[model samples]
Structures are given as structure tokens and as C-alpha cells.
Target: MPDVLFAATLTNRATRLDAVLATMDGTMLRRGHEIYPAPFGPDAFVAAFVRLARGLLRSEAREGVHIAGAALALEAVLDAGAGKVVAMPMAADWGAFPLSERLTTASGATSGVAIVSLTDAALLGEMTLGAGRGVTNAVLLDLSRSVSAAFCYEGKLLQRPYLGAIGHIPVPGATWRCACGGHGHLETVASAQSLVRWMIGRLVEAPATEAAVMRLTGGRAEALTAPQIWQMACEGDPVAAELMGAANDALAHVILTLLLALDPERVILSGALAQCGPTWRDALARAIIQIAPPARAGELAACLALGELGPAATIKGALALARQRVISITG
Candidate 1:
């Protein structure tokens, strides 16, 4: 029996799902947008569950499935009838894992940055499965559960766990707060939402109407349609261009800050915004050039490369995990 894992992705806004899939190893299989709920249903609630069961059964091997990100999706996969679920939940104590899982070997030429890919919900989910692979000397963070909490580790296991949450949610002053009552988080500042909020703010007093805003940025409804903003910038809109520049600059600063704290060899970025286009990439390089110190920049080469994982990093990572079951039982 080959161990196979199943993961699902419901995010189909402002991005192409295939982008995230670029990072997966050949062993994993990922499928997305296969289920559509009622138009008014909005959430992927019902269909997501259906897909989970189907994917699990579809796998030739009897690998256990693990649902990630939204609890609803997880619930749906569970309801659909998965044999086992392997979730590295933010709420779980990750310190129990073996040492190799905690230790990570950063990829690329950068000797000072970790080439990590991040998505909306489960920050470390993809890294643990994909990039982080089987490294044991590592830490998995999710601010959604607790802002002040993180899973610390020794050589290959949890050493002393404490509050060290990472990932995004809640803007400092934005009314969109987190379920934990905290306003502003790594999600708020760096997420695609950050760009969306910026575009809405630039709207010419149109009540932030979707129709009007869509017209403003070419009819996109994603929380942060950076591409639309990029287009506006390209079309010579000073305000739009400024926001685009600032957003990259801001994100670069954040990365710089992370470099000081964590000594990863390379920082691999996996998101729609990271690959808006050549112009967006250029602007990001410029921003990093200006804000980051020359020495730090030289001493460390943390690149902002686009992740091949597409939009299904989480799911592929999960399914890849399921495949592990096949090897375990057979080997």
C-alpha cells in the first residue's frame, strides 16, 4: 500500500491555482476547483467535502488523507469519509516530531535565508510537506491560533514551545480583525488583501462598490488585486503606481526584518502578488534595494522568487503526505 495524502484548495480569486502546484515533487497529485457550490453559497463548504472523499477514494493506494487550512474543508473531507487525518494544526504541539523534521535545509544560493513558501491559512503547511520536506530542526508557526505562540524545537524535536506566532490576519487599524480579537497581523500586512485594501482606498469615493472598484482596477473582486493595481500603474496612474511600489517596498522591509530574526538560506515567495509581472518584480527588487542595507543584502541573498506550487501548495503537500503511507506499508 502506498501512503497518499489529500489536500484541497478553495481559493480561486485573483490568482491562478497552477502557480502553487509548480513547487510540488512528482510524487504528489493535486486537483482544484473540481466542485462548485450554489452561487449564493459562496464558501466552498459543501463541494469541498465532496471532493475530499472523491480524492481519497480516487487514489489507488490506501494512503490516509489530511485536510488543511479552513476547518470547513477539513470537516468536509472528514464527512466525505477519510480513513485518517494528518493535520499539523497550529493548535497542536509540534514539539513531539522527530529531529529530522525540525531541521530544514534552505535551498538556493542564499546562505542566510530560508526558501519558504507561504499561503493564507496554514503558513508552515507547505514547507513541512514540500520545501521543508523531512527536515526536523525547524519551527512551524500559525498566528491564527494564538498570536503569542509558536512551536520551538531542539535538534530534531520540540525544545521549549512558546508564543511566537507568524503568518497573517487582522490589520492594525483595519476594521477587519481576527477571530482572536487581535487587529493586524502578518496576514493583514503581507496578504493579497493588503493590496486589495489599498486599491479600495484609492477608489474615487465610490463607496468601495465592487462594480465601481472593478471598473477602477479592471473588474477584479479579490481582496488584493495587485495585478489590476499594476495595470493602473503601468497605465500611468501615479496613485496606483505609488501603491504598487509601496506594497512591494513594505513587503521587502518585512522580509528584511525576518532575515534578522531567522537565518534561513533563501526566502522563496509563493503567491500571486509575488509574480504580478516583470514590472512588479522590478519594483520589488528596487524596493528591497532601497530599504535593505547593502551589506545585509550582500551578506545574505534571500530571493523573492515565485513558488511553482501555484495555488495548491497546501493540497499537494497534503496529498504528498498521503503518498507516504503507500511507501510505508509497502516498504
Candidate 2:
């Protein structure tokens, strides 16, 4: 039987599960996938995983199952009786010992459990198969509801707990508040959700710009999303353009901070915001170069790039982690 690789990624907005059937030689066969809105808590997350896993199983023989998620999701899978599990933490906050203990208690389980960080997985995937391919040093920034970054050096990922919470760091002069009760966080200005909120606020202040975004969202300001804002900006709406520029400036600040601190050879942008395309890229690049130290401006300008894996990046990274586990076992 071909090796079956199951991977799941949970962000604040959604959860995605994907399975690929591959031969021992690493050739992919059938692939199946599913997505759901993110659950509320640990119990809800566990229930969702069980339901998704059951539907995916479809009477296939039990092999190893690889899961990538936050702490609760991994615990849920272990409690649900998946055999020979490999759990990867999608965020730095999750615990490994508790999940490992749960896996150890499962009956008839001969396979061992391994805990890996999703940061490592993402770096590995990028270096091996995605945009950062052949690069020695780089950073992958996931720009979703919350921002997280992974560092890669000498083709290996360096997992750091502080890196996962970089988005929570306060940005100077930011007026919005974060969910964590912090003011001026990068997430308050740079995240897709924050951008949506900022756009809504802009509509309230500038009633004239309301027509375009209201038309885009079908007459509801609350329904306006970051992509819609970008669309409006593309269409030359002054309000949308200003909001996009401000958001991009905030993001550029974050990127500039990372570049100066890490000095990586490449910086890869990923997640929903990155999907806004070249308009967003151009704005971010412009901001980076405008503020970059003149001596290193040319070098920094060449370092920014988009993630090649797109929305599938985290899942692909999880799959790569699973593949590595299989290799280590069979080698």
C-alpha cells in the first residue's frame, strides 16, 4: 500500500485538512482535501478533527497520520485514536508533553510520536519545493489574522518561541487596539482582519468612498474584506488607496525590522494578504526601499518575494514533515 500522508493547518480564521497518497519513492497518487471555519475551543476543535478524519478515512487501512495544528487540535486527534501519529505545532504556544502522553496511552499503538514545529516544516517545504528553493538564509512570514515568521539558515529552520508572537509587538503611532488588549500591535494595522476594520472605519469617516466599497460588499460595510479593499484601491478609490497604503506601510515596518534583525538573504510573504497581488507587493516594496538605509537599499530591494506555495503552504509544510518522519523510520 502507498504511504498515506494526512496534514491539517489551523489558523484563527479557518482549518484545512489535506491527504496525499504517495508511494515509498515519494510519488504522489490520490489527493483529498477539506476545509472548515475554525472551531471555538479545544472540545470543538477535537470534534471537528474527529468528524473530518472519519470522513477522510473512508475504510482505508490504518497507517501513520500526520497532523499540523495548535495544541488543542493535536490533542483532539490523539484522543480520537489515530494510529502512529506525528503532531506538529502550528503556533509556538502549544505543549508537546501532554500530546505525547495522550498518544502513549492509545491501545495497540506500536509507532512512536514526534512533535515538530510548523515553522520548521514551512522552512523545510520552502527550501525543498517552494519559493525559497536553493536559498541558504531566509524568512517566511505568514500574514494572516496573526503574523508569524520562520527563519531558515544553512537550509535548516530555526524555531524560536518569540518569533510566533512578533505580530503582537506594538507598532509606533498605531491607533487601533489588538484582541489581546494591546494597543498599536502590528496585527492591528497589518493583518487582513485589521485592514477590513480600518476600511469600515474609513467608510464611516469618508462617506464619499462608501459607494464603491458598499457596492463591492453588496451594500454592507461590515462585509467588506481586505481583498475587496484592495479591489477598490485598484479601481482608484481614494479611501481604499489610502487604507491600502497605510496597511502596506505598517507591514513594511515589520518587514524592515525583521530584515535588519535577521539579515536573511530572502524574505517570503505568505497568507491571505499576500493574495492581493502585485498592487500590494508594489506598495510594500516601495515602502521598504524608501526607508531602507541607502547603503544597503539595493540589496534589501532584491530580498522581498512572494510565497510560491500560496494558500497550500502550511499544508505542504505539514506534508513535508510527515515525509521526513517516514524517511527517518524507513531509512
In terms of TM-score, how similar is model 2 to the real structure? 0.77
Cα error of candidate 2 at position 197, Å: 1.1
What local distance difference test score does each model get?
A: 0.40, 0.62
Q: Candidate 1 residues 1-331, lDDT tens each? A: 4222333443332121221111113343444444333221222333334444354445434454322211111211111112222223331322132211111111111111111112322223444544344433333322111222122233222222222334443333444454345665545544555556656765664443435456764555454365666776787666666656555555566556655676544344555564465566556666676767787764443344333454455455434433333334345
Candidate 2: misplaced stretches above 4 Å? 11-21, 25-97, 100-123
Native-referenced Cα lDDT, model 2: 0.62
TM-score of 1: 0.52
Model 2: per-residue lDDT, tens digit, 81-194?
222123223433232325433432331112333333444455556766788987899888777666767788776656433445677878778867787788888888788878
Q: What is the TM-score of each candidate against the true structure?
A: 0.52, 0.77
